[model samples]
Target: MVAIWLDGRMRPSTAASVLVISARQVQRLLRRYRESGAGAIRHGLRGRPSNNRIDCGVRDYALAIVRETYADFGPTLAAEKLAERHGLTVSSETLRKWMIDDGLWKNRAQRRNFHPPRLRREHCGELVQIDGSDHRWFEDRSPACTLLVFIDDATGQLMQMRFVPSESTFSYFEALEGYLKDHGRPAAFYSDKHSIFRVSKTEARTGHGMTQFGRALAELNIEILCANSSQAKGRVERANRTLQDRLVKELRLAGISDRAEANAWLPTFIEQHNAHFARVPARPKNLHRPVNEPASRLRDILCWRDERYVGNNLTVSYERKRLILEDSDLARSAVGHYVETYAFADGRVDLRWKGVSLPYRMFDKDQQRVTHAAIADNKRLSEVLAYAMEMQKAAPPKMPRTGKQRTRYEPTGLRSPGPKSLLAKRAERRVAEAAAQAVE
Candidate 1:
């Protein structure tokens, strides 16, 4: 269009129309092309660096921090940390480009998925998604264990987390206790169809068709919802994935190997994690209800409870152990009545009748299995088996028998052995005489 206009073969208006610009723009470009000879078509700032580009020293510092502290963090998270912690004001996209150029990060191809996204709850504590992740959290430093995660559905905040051996009822009980004390009771708990939360069998002859965990939640007036699939409880499942990546590294950095130390350090990590990842609730109001129940009542509700009938001797058999109730007026009247037995996670058992604790002496019917207080789940099966083998090796060898054992023999058929007593001899002689008379 400019060439036609320069050659005077076409009008500026026609050239402007062809070039998709105004006539004035065509005239301006034509004059510039006359002066600069096609060089004027290039942008003036093409070869210059961006004025808003980050300084070299700042970029170096940010990259150093990423390498040193957050090498595995995603670009967005790394950018956030760079700004918040190191005062490097870089955008996530810019940081991602830089990381890609530096070979510190890679861009992954996006994949289509079938699970639809669910909206967050309206208020905090409206729903808490609970899950247990079995991971080698401590790497090879310690035995693998399960981490119980309690995440709020409304805000995507981690309510509580604990390192346990397995996803057992007792482990959940302990985690629930901590959650109750820390954040009070949530309206409902969201979880999978684990036996701890739901009775999987339809014909299960257990406590009113509810699991121990379900019963405990019912006692606390907290509803338990079991998701049909893992994607249904995706909040906690995703949290587990994040923890398996970040928490494991955190534990490694902190030199923590055991559950006790990991537990102690968990609060700090949770606070930090929530600060970065937690989202604002849709509603400002907190939905968590205060725990109005007394500590004792709460303790009772959170324990493993079973019913046993008191015998005529005022004794109750539990787990093959006899509990002899003290002879009292209450005990005497308790005979033939049903009593409740509460077993706490801390290994304490309380026998109660009509909400009153009964005094009793335990007569152990069998020795209990050797158990470790720190261990909780099957993640440590290998360690437990190794320990058992070691114990067996350390045990004293059994003594060998010295002499052959004798076997008692009896006379065959109707023939009798020689009698040792006078009464036996008389009986034998009478039998023989009767036999001889019959023969004659």
Candidate 2:
């Protein structure tokens, strides 16, 4: 443009339009080009120091203080401490450069581990990401707990939120039950490879590769997808991070220190959060289908279900409890067969055979004792330890089976029956004598 303008082939206005610069600026460039040739295109202040440069003494003093005191601090924090503590005001970027030059800090390029970004589902309820975040939600005021978060992939809206003691199958069942009630049934749920969603063990002996929660979803005709990585279900993971910050502060402000209160308050926070962060879906269609089952039936679907084989005595052992079925025709028929056991959230257990509920009584064993090899997941470790401690306090100190009372078995100083055969013969004689006396 300058050459054309200088040759008078193009007007100054035309050159200005082509270069997207003012006509006067174009004229100035043309004048400089004519006088000094192409070398004039370089900036005049290329090698000059900035006019607002700090004094050498001040720069030295700031760097000295930072090295002596805030050596491990980042540029931004070091700058803040310099201004606050020493009255030395310096921008973070300026300090960053100076620290880099002084070898106190190194300017490192941020290297991001690239992941293939997944596009959001077009319709709402097409995919909902579910996760449980175990955190100190109440800070130091209360014990840490897990928060189950349900978020939509399409709109990024929080579909449901619940605070639970831990990430267990039962906890997930309760949260999912609430979600199904509110939002009906979604096409599918996206989740991490938690055992509640997927059977992690390849050689799992029970449920035929399906988890209890997975079975519930299958029964409801809903699909559940297990993500290979946290980034695959990034929506719920990111929401957990945000809630850890915002929701924790909100709970503190509301003076909520327990799961119950926080759970009751979560609905309002979810609404506000969705209002701020939710996006409009690409396709403005709702893919959620209404559940046709009643609430009672839905609850039945959400509970822990397993099959226990009834013994000859019409009893089934479950969770260290002997379920003694009532003596009836149904109970007799159920013996030597597998009866389905439904354990509900509210501590109710029902025994059913062929869809007929058989009345039963629970004979509890020492289920409360934490066995030597009891395995608890990382998320539930706190709760498990707490309960173990409580049980330890209440239960008697365990005695070794082989520990002797000194050296030998001391006589208990009480009468003992000689033998089972003799006792049975005496009982028969007594009954026969009673029958003869009655006839007389």
Candidate 3:
């Protein structure tokens, strides 16, 4: 109170007189106020220069290198990149602080101290976060790949990860099938608003109302919830960050190069990783629910789609041989009409005509014409011939032979190189002529 009173404008002598404390105390308080200002009252470290801070130019250089090529890098690795590539002398902590202040970096798996309104799902298999991380997974050894990660929200366990060429409906189908086989289907899948899961298709103001993946999930009775923002489903995104870091290192150490080896090694790696990081039981027993679908139905649930044209004989030729739709309404009505054929991964085909179910018999599936087959032979052959003629016309004219060279030389076919030594060749030719004339 005396210190504050002195600071507020009470005369030093008057403050000492009021408090009965020595004037030296008032002098010390005033000295501290003068030296440290209001910050002194807060206690602990405040605005002091950190011993671990990176030098400004080196920090800026590190920032530039990160921005140019490695912006997604976390601090520790970014620091190593700085040391190796940019020659910046700095620790990870220093780089972290500099980047955090600059808003160029964040700790992805940071733990918050406060509680939120929405708690996690009660069981491990209740909700799973699914996302694809497109990464240079094998670093220099392989081209980039997409890792389709399925992580449980409650237990933070990575259920399955599939390395794919790209993120597509079929890729997810493959991933989901793998996930189901490993841990069974979760009650609901939480994911981003990617077109695969949450596409809104419109056709001249009329809605298709179903994407391929959405339809697949619907058929499987799996509910999908799309998060509006990244933060809403931070778990999988965080997992993507972790996997991108750890998986890259793991692959490099294991000498795994590219998609083939990485994929082959993924199962073993996942087992080891999950063993180390998988969370302990919160409620004792495992919460993963078994798949409810019959094995036959599950087979048809995951597959690609094809389209077929019905013939005049009330039969559809699929996979080569004629698939006679016997007494079939689809065969009778869909004559001269194109019908859709959904080809499951397990090779089962489902045919539908104008949204009506069509019973199909895939007698010779190998001979069935592809739904959207390429151009026919005659058309393609004509196009090739026309292209050849056009290429001949467009090509540059060849340089003509000069004076003496034109008489004996052919231009296009194979030819021997002209002799470098004219005298040696002339003597040899003269000797040959003398021998021929002598024989004659």
Tell me how far the alpha carbon of residue 382 in candidate 2 is from the true structure, in angstroms, after superposition.
0.9
For model 2, how does the per-residue alpha-carbon lDDT over 1-440 read when each residue is reduced to its tens digit?
Answer: 78777778999898889989899998789788889997897778878987788988989999999999999999999999999999999999999999998988876653356689999999999999999999999999999999999999999999999999999998988898789879999999999888888988888676668989999999999899999889899989899999899999999899999999888888999899999999999998899999999878988899999999999999999887888899999889888999998998887888899999999887875665787799998888998998899898888788768866578889899999666797799999999999999999
Scored by lDDT, model 1 comes in at 0.87
**Which lDDT values do the candidates have, in the order given?**
0.87, 0.90, 0.75
Error of 1 at 186 (Å): 0.9
Question: Residue pairs in steric clash, candidate 2?
Answer: none
- Point out where model 3 deviates above 4 Å: 1-118, 201-208, 285-287, 292-294, 305-330, 336-340, 344-440
**Tens-place lDDT digits, model 1, residues 277-391:** 9999989999888899998788888889999999998889887688899999988888999998999988788988888889999877443433455453354565466656676
Deviation (Å) of 198 in candidate 3: 0.7
TM-scores for every candidate against the unseen true structure: 0.61, 0.66, 0.49
Tell me the number of clashing residue pairs for each predicted model.
Answer: 2, 0, 7
Question: lDDT tens digits, residues 361-410, model 3?
Answer: 65554432222344533313433345456655766545666777646855
Best-performing candidate as measured by lDDT: 2
TM-score of 3: 0.49
